[model samples]
Target: MNTLMVMGYGNSIAMSQILVVVVEILLLVKIGEPLECKRKEIVTNTPVISSNCYRECEYPSKPTVCEYEFNVVLHQTMSAHCGDCPFKKEDCNLEKCVPVDGSSRPLIAVNGSLPGPSIVVCEGDTIRVKVTNNLQSGAGVTMHWHGIHQTNTNWMDGVPRATQCAVARGSSFVYEFIAEPAGTHWWHSHAGYQRASGAFGPLIVRKSRKTEFNSNTYDFDLPEHTMTLTDWADMTSLDIALKVNIPALNPRSQTVTILMNGKGERIEFFDETGQIFKTPRQMFEVEAGKKYKIRLIGAFIAACMTSFHIEKHSMTIISTEGGEIIPYETDYLTIAQGERYDFVLHANAVPSAYCIYASGYGNSSCPSNATFILKYKSSPLNNPTCASYAVVPASQDRDQYMGNRSKGMFSAIDFVSSDPGDQELYRVDLRHYITLRSYAIYKHPKDPGYLNGFLAVDNVIYTPPLLPFVTNEPDDSDICQSTLNKTFYYTCGMKQCVCTNILKIKLGKVVEIVFLNTDEDIIQHPMHMHGGSFRLLGLGSFHTKKMTLDNVIQLDKEGGLLRNSPVKAALKDTVMVPSNGYAILRMKAENPGYWFFHCHTMNHGERGMVIVLQFGEPSEMPKPPLDFPRCEGWEPK
Candidate 1:
């Protein structure tokens, strides 16, 4: 028999008797167990103060108090390079700067710097930013913290004309508030286009808690860098305005030099001596297996699609203005104006030093500035040749991963001409025409004592008309037309024109908006809506032509276009309208509230290229809340 045997620590049993012997041995071992092996009952301790009954204090002032201090001053100095231009000169052109006080003379900049100090803080921290205006002119200024959910802190919203009065020149205003929501943001002057003249800076909010995916650590371990893109015009802003308003003058064709950070090393026009300005180029050193994070901020007047690449390293887009996305790995990423992106690069085995390149999208005249560099550690492997480095294409279509299909189409208008046989498909509930005008500094009769020109919609200076739809009687039409044209002199104001205020549409009803850019100014204006996005139905030139869906569509010399594009996804916020053209935006007013509609150009918005949306039950109310401050005697007592 195949005998089975059971063996214990020091004893063995044969097959037939193994089962009986094993049971007996186990029983003896169990009975001989020590007392320490016995189970014991556990009792939980209770707290004296009950956690279940705890409640948060309803009072606002009971929390721990915190304070922060900051200061602002103006100094006089000069830099040869203006933005990303390669030309360096020894001229301090103060006239080109926006006056701190609404005056004729320009103020010397703070620290003699364009784009002032960056305000950095962590969430829940109270920040006190002090501004002391030392310009010769007594100007009023205000700062708006963009995208920083002001909520009830409307006092700090910083609309100079809409909120509180501008901080007087030679005076100071203490902006005290708690920073909320950690992310990338900016602050700019709300008192006219002072921001355009170098009154802006980064407003960073650091995370309060320890995050699993720490961007700061990622930034510290690898090469870290930043780039701020801005557009600069050669002429004083005032002159640019005058040219834009006067059709005959047609001054909008001016070339804009895009600045990277504070560097001027891209465009050839500024490099008179042809000597490369190497100071602006950025460089970094990295170990073969290290990682890097690059922060890009588009603060310019135009929208840009950027491409970034290092020879062999793959890029991962970690975050956008909307916060972190499901970290996507890509060769390159596209970013638009008023947007920020954080990308990570794992430089594993790149072999040799690789040049990181950043370029703009479309056929932009603006060239890319080498704002930073990435250096690799020495390795025994053969050095990688420059030819072996993967080059990132500037165009989205050319990118093998991005593909060539257009993201969206363009449309200008959606209306059938009034012909009796035509289907009365839709009635015009709100029919109005708006004409934007820019004027020269000296063109204004009032001489607000500034170089900048005045802006108006429909020949009405500083007055946007109300909507719903009204037509003037023939007899009254002639007189009204005459007053409008002669009142501004900027445009022979034509009467029987549409109003600017109160664009009324049926609740939840689909409506089309026809945007006409009559200003001979050739500068493209990206018209963005705050609450919703629309589809481009059609485009029209001197000869009307049907176009495709495009969120940012350029308008041509003569405005005409059809709306036959398919319905696209509904998005919220911003659309661009090209110069000398028209854009037709279609939207269904679903969420009702007051929304801001304006041009994305920083200067244009300050010059009155903005209006409000009033959505709700219809009313015969004469005017909406023209929330202008009482300073200029425009507000009612």
Candidate 2:
């Protein structure tokens, strides 16, 4: 590993003790394809100590042991720059979107921007933000730092009713935590359907944590080249939530409109007064023959998936869900709702403007498309031979370090010398061979046939709690728990089956989950996990009947299940269970807290298909903030 030097700070301490730092400088002497290796840390800085890490891998075979290091550094408090993390929800007017249809809809904006504001920071920088709910009188709001491993501060997971209650309406909530594993991530309101109202934005963390890092990824990483694609509705999110289950509002037939940066190439932007201004299409400009890093985020609350593609450019996928992945080249990539992807774009093409297109999928209703431009500035109309290096754009600037083609792409990622974890059969601790088919808690029949109102886990339904489990009080009760008497089914408002069902998991146990997408639903399910990421063990073939736990366990015993990848790399939080097939996933319950696992489709999770995985002893977890906001009255609207 390359030696890294930390400087600039006058004090001995770093950011904060709880800060997340990727200490990538570890020397490992490999023997015969990773036969054996040891890791030792030499602390060179004061005001720092180590803690137990949640990233632990206990392999029973050729063990894939990871260096467990939780270095804490003390320093002055940190604050987000006003320019990056802009304001209170009510005070900002971040977005003014007018789609092609010329509709004036209300959206949750930040600093007056539609897609909210981008929180850009470096690897080790801690973040602090104050979010105020300025919506209706009693409307509640809570922000979930999507794809971020909250690490030691699991209470700051921002999951209402689980980690902490929602920040009540007309209230303010402060979120402070460390951000790690630099790449692309986003934040959105976890309260009700608020995210659908535009309560979401990009959060980027860059800079290598290692002293020596790979550069040849891209020539220039223009932070300004950030954009978002989402499914937009003219009606309020609450209204949509109320009517979504109705036959008239059947999602199957209601194609939605797609927008980029909250703006589409619709009727030129005209205000309520019938005035028009330049409705600029989302665009990115780059120097001719230059390589650029572009971050793409999906914040679709209604749509299930969106396929993104550029007219004349191929994207090199370098990172996924805030973690660097095996850099792979592809023409197009499908981004499900709530997922982020970062790719390098090489403007090697002759100087020209190219169309960046995105279309939402999985929904026959509300179909939408967003188009933007990737214009190369100052390209010779005709191919010129003699080129002048003449001080082209900034390069080698640490900020522009998102560079180069990596030769060891396979080393740390897929091209690894060896992976001991793959040698042993899957033995994840949850013990239960869980098999779930995607279904619905219908507004009418047991099987509504189409994705209309509420979606539920075919095996069970989960209801978000009114009170958080992260409080000082012990959680000795949950609706899903079997009572001493007969199995009790609880109901809240109009639903007889809605109740909180928490899936308790032991810490450091290997577990496997097989999701079977039933044919009852016409769409695929993009399942996602919060607080913890899983290894995609395998994707099975389409099955007509839902396999029981016994059957899956039998298949594993018989070596019928597909194992690890042979060529490509795998580490992801979201995986799509085919419309009539299944996806098997494995993971170690390392993090100790209430972790949410659900389908990424916002509407699907809001209604059902949301399950909580409780790791470790609840009492051992960190306590909620002293002034933690209570969401007792903030029930589903």
Candidate 3:
């Protein structure tokens, strides 16, 4: 009487005799009859190797998706110390890398190249790079497009924990974004410290030559002339980071060698065997009497301030960070990390090979130097006798470039922006002053042995959130708003203030961000802001012995602040804030999304020198894709 009905595909059983009926139904399905069901098949698109690798980018009449496949994996240099490079065997393995740096250290390569593959496209073209993390070591990776304005496609920015999660091992991620504001740019790893292990390359966004700002100044702009400057070491970035974080290790982790376009002679600093081998150098070919437009990218991971100069030639800088500037000639260029310069080199010297020199400049820098040959097309293949390292500049003073020692030296203030926006940043709606400093921060309040060096902005170490802010609205308990309750910069000094530093800016509001490098021990920091370029208002040291935010504010109110050319200030995304000095930047918060603002120096940035800039409201931001990879904090469940 207490019967229950159980439903099957085409039969029902009463609970009174359920056990007997279930056994009968199981026998019927397994032996007596076949169950009818519809099976589904799933198909996944196979990644294809595009044959357009390294081909010249065309300026398309209409925008199109420039898809690229990036297979990131652990690779090694060819043979021993790249001695067997330049192989021409038809059956030779293309996956083997040849850095030509005379070191067979392990590297993380993209598409089987040291500097990876260059992404050259026209402005407004959509770039879709499907990155497959092929590393068998169970590592994750992400690529950041340096100097790219993500605009409505903020998720494609490639900053893990800020924009999106890392592409996990054996997984793939498709980064799709529209390229705009054509200029010399680059792409590199934003995860796993893999960029220093040779995971970066040039990214040139081209527009019509006729529409270029300083087009008439140069006669030719070739793809081969684009050079990437980087610092290399025999050890991996993780080893260097370990030595740096734990200072008691007596860190000899400075630049062992510098590379130009992934070519350099090996330096045996860490090589205990002291084995040296001859390695080939990069050669830039030029025709006689032709003015060549050379695009230089400073992609260094170290804190080395590199100065580049070509012997018997002068460089006329026309543009910086993709913005056209008033042309100025200089004997050499002192470039920091994450900076780009487009200069015109007039091949006026006699038809012969000349040494292009690059040497480290400033204090706290090692004697890291590199050389490349600039040879005329018809010249013989001979090494120049004068192809030696140039003497490093003795003057460590950066601000002295404006005074008596300014000849043949040009900084950002020396050149003015030729074409600025219609709305000048004469005044701003909000102002935020941050002091760039490095000091010891103990992890625990009562523990002194747990102290580690941390680079901070306004005494707050920027720790990235586990869940990306772009997709998830993290609770206030997750982020550390140190400045909300603080008034002065030195209040939290030596107190270990670490958190996800967030700076919110309203839409269309012009904001002024002043960087104060009042800390005497700290050197120059190349501060790079994401999303868009800004107006470089000023850069100079304070007159007082001890300067603070309040002091700078009073100086600004009294018109005592040293400023650049107000009308022709340079437009830049990265500005070098001098040591014991200051830098002023102004821009309108138009891009409505979360962006990164941090020191481009990888060592400093990794040790908490960063800030998250949230522009506009959540409603104004573009929504991410439905199937986009989502990440969150995972507690011990």
TM-score of each: 0.53, 0.71, 0.85
Instruction: Please state the error at residue 528 of candidate 1 in Å.
Output: 5.9
List the candidate 1 regions with Cα displacement exceeding 4 Å. 1-108, 208-224, 233-239, 242-256, 266-278, 284-288, 302-314, 349-371, 375-596, 613-637
Q: Rate the local accuracy (lDDT) of all candidates.
A: 0.45, 0.58, 0.76
**Runs in model 3 lying further than 4 Å from the true structure:** 1-61, 78-95, 248-255, 267-277, 387-391, 396-405, 442-451, 480-484, 488-490, 542-544, 565-567, 633-637
Candidate 2 lDDT, tens digit per residue, 222-316?
56787778877656666776566544434432335677776554444345687554334566788877788888887777645566667667888
- Candidate 3 local lDDT, 1-637, one digit each (tens): 8965567654543554777978897877576231112122324433222313233344443454566778898887644433334333221224454654666677888877778888877777677787889987788899999989998988889999888999889888888888777899999999858888888999988777657778899898888899898888777888878776765434664446778887776533223366433556788999999999999999988876787889899999988888888888888787889999999999999999998888775555544567888999989954675545544555634553232225566667767888866464676788888778898665553464554678998788888887887788756875754336554336667577777888888898888888988877446788998899888888786534677667778978898766775457888899888777888888889999999999988888988888888898778899898877778657896
Q: Ten consecutive residues with minimal summed lDDT in candidate 3? A: 32-41
Candidate number achieving the greatest TM-score relative to the actual structure: 3
Clashing pairs counted in every model: 42, 36, 0
lDDT of 1: 0.45
TM-score of 1: 0.53
Candidate 3 TM-score to native: 0.85
True lDDT of residue 497, candidate 1: 27
